[model samples]
Target: MQSKTPISDPTLLQLPLDTRTLTIGGLAIKIYGLGAHSASTPLTCIHLLHPRQQTHEYMTGIARSLLHTYGTQALICASFDSRNHGARTTSPLANESWKGGNATHAEDMFSVYHGTVEDLRMVVEYLGVYLRRVVRHFVVGVSLGGHAAYLALALPRVEGVVSVIGCPDFVRLMAARAEGCGVDVRGVFGGAGLGPIVGRLDPAAVGMVGLREVWRGKRLLALSGGADGLVPYACSQPFLDEVKKAVWRGELELDLEDIVYEGVRHECTSEMVREIVRWFAACFEDMDGGSLKSSLAL
Candidate 1:
């Protein structure tokens, strides 16, 4: 693979794990993604979480392309089924909220975070131990996967985080959805003793409160499409605003470019993909003071 252009390789590798089942807090979960790592890799590891209800192949391919384009070779990409979205149907709350639980949706989300962070932690630990490599690990996610990425970053292993088209205000979105369904959102989280819990687990709230402390001096990037409707471009704005006025203030920058390809929705676009690749490439490539190009390798 040359540094001049990104690789067009579609070949992906699947790990030879005995089992993909992960048990956390008495809750079982499944992971359906790639675990690709070559011998003698570097420390800057990448953990990519896919969108809701997406396959591992799709997510891993995107991650691989991003890594290849960025010239960041020290990376390992992994994607998993959060709950009842994929091959984890045996688990409770598959494709639905927790049944008869006091907090319902909030509890479900909590379970997801608890389970997901643990899975990611295990992967990082395994790579560090078994692979005998990796020092600086970063996480990137999109949509619901973006929230999971934040959760993983909150864990011990993750060093930095990149959230793409993810809404940090989980409670707010659920509340709006509840209203759309004619259900009282406040009653759901509040009545179920989830309001405070949500305050504790909400990504936006967490980012505002202690994320800076946890990720102090760490590079964080919030990427989103300007015309995104599903996750809303507004979601990333408030956090950027809060961080600008906060304790961990530094050269933190947020990229707000929207790829306007036809029929491109909340999903990843070729331009967006190429931009990510170029950004990664710029990080490692010797630029020789030349202006970086604004494009993707579609």
Candidate 2:
């Protein structure tokens, strides 16, 4: 089933800096304050392949940056753990028959992705309800979380997405994972027919093709580092190609852009955060050209 569902039994407690902690649909999430000038709605951040602890500061910082740039209360920010990653390191489904029934680790990753897509949708829907406002939503994700951002694009409310160091084509990512350093295939992957395993579970085949409809009026910013050893430039080609197609078709007006940090790799630097903050600002307004250039140049 698709992850799209109404929020259930959500409980939220407001804290300092306008942030809050809430649990809904069995997931725990953090919400940073709404932008000074924004509605109670939010831009959600999906963490990397890891859990929420590692990237919380950076993710919340993006929300804070948006608040500073837009100066509007419309841009609230949020984040949550991916399946079997951070706090929920022991996902119930991870041990279910469907998880490892197929013997390839790439497929295992797909299983995780499937669960994450659901988790994200649940949270987005829940937040919409909890805020009790006419909320507009945006998403940003890193690594596997970035891929989740792409999937979230299909949601009607998600108007913009920033996918950092992530790819839309799961097939390619699976191949890369299959070849990651020191992968002992004889045990987890069952050691045979690696190529065929990822083929059956291609995210494109699973559900990404509909991004055409989902992306009709959306904006996307894809960031990659040139020297990165993992998730090399090629892995992002499919997402770039999709963006190019949208721009050529006039389906996107603002933020149809991509950037590569020649010296950076696998990791998004503080400078990248500045750039993303700028990209989001462009999405909301035609701000002064002077500040605009500085955000992108960082």
Candidate 3:
């Protein structure tokens, strides 16, 4: 689903900036563009997630970019530290992979991201009440955050997801990593292979039949790096292929746009950010049945 057209540099729309923080159910959530003056208005909230070992501050620039583009439209951007990250850091070693000496790398990473999904669900459930306004939820995740974005698809409130360098097949990715790291695959995947815990949490383990129900009516824009050595695109291709098949067969009504940038690495490039902004604009247009050309105008 790579785009044939050339991707140009993004021209950000500069607007008034408003930043604030709230502690919701023990999670410190940072919000941008939604202030006391605008809390009563209905808005769409886009949650931005950072990469592994990074804090919510890592997403500040992108949050500002999104707010500048949609702030006037009652759109707010929010972000929070994932489990074992930022303010939630309990054991830094738990964040590392097998190569970094984490014996239970697979379970640790999966739990962190899966727990993030649950945290998001709780935030979404209570956010409206706090603001006293109707709120819609969308998510944009990068690297480790991207993996969480896939799991967030199951959330009833999340309508769209933008995954940058994320993998859907956690078991495959972990198996490959374990092999390369000289760690016993059995230790990671277990003696039975693809351990019960991973099978229960991994998105690819859900199978296409289950995915049909989870992905229906959702919008996904997956940006991958073709040469990504860390989270290789190959690990996710099989699942993406099945997703496309389901869509083509009318079994899943999903708005899926998966693109691989040739020669790119695991990093999120400026071009990827541009595509994300454009995709968000397009999704907003589709939802409202109105043009946002002016909002995106340079």
Stronger candidate by lDDT (1 vs 3): 3
User: Candidate 2's residue-wise lDDT over 83-133, tens digit each?
Assistant: 666566664444332223433445455566657767766765666566555
* Candidate 1 Cα errors over 4 Å, as ranges: 1-43, 70-72, 91-93, 96-106, 207-209, 247-264, 282-298
Which clashing pairs does model 1 show? Answer: 70-280, 70-281, 84-94
Model 2 spans > 4 angstroms off: 1-16, 34-58, 91-104, 180-209, 249-255, 286-298
Positional deviation of 223 in candidate 2, in angstroms?
A: 0.5
Clashes of 2: 10
Candidate lDDT (C-alpha), each: 0.52, 0.56, 0.80
Those runs of model 3 whose alpha carbons end farther than 4 Å from true positions after fitting are 1-16, 191-194, 290-298
TM-score, each model? Answer: 0.69, 0.70, 0.89
Q: For residue 296, give model 3's deviation from the true position in Å.
A: 27
Model 1 vs truth, CA RMSD: 8.4
Which clashing pairs does model 3 show? none
Q: 171-256 in candidate 1: lDDT tens per residue? A: 65565545545556656566656677667766666665566455544445556667665655555566556666663355333222
Cα lDDT of model 3 by residue, 248-272, tens digit? 9998888899999999988887788
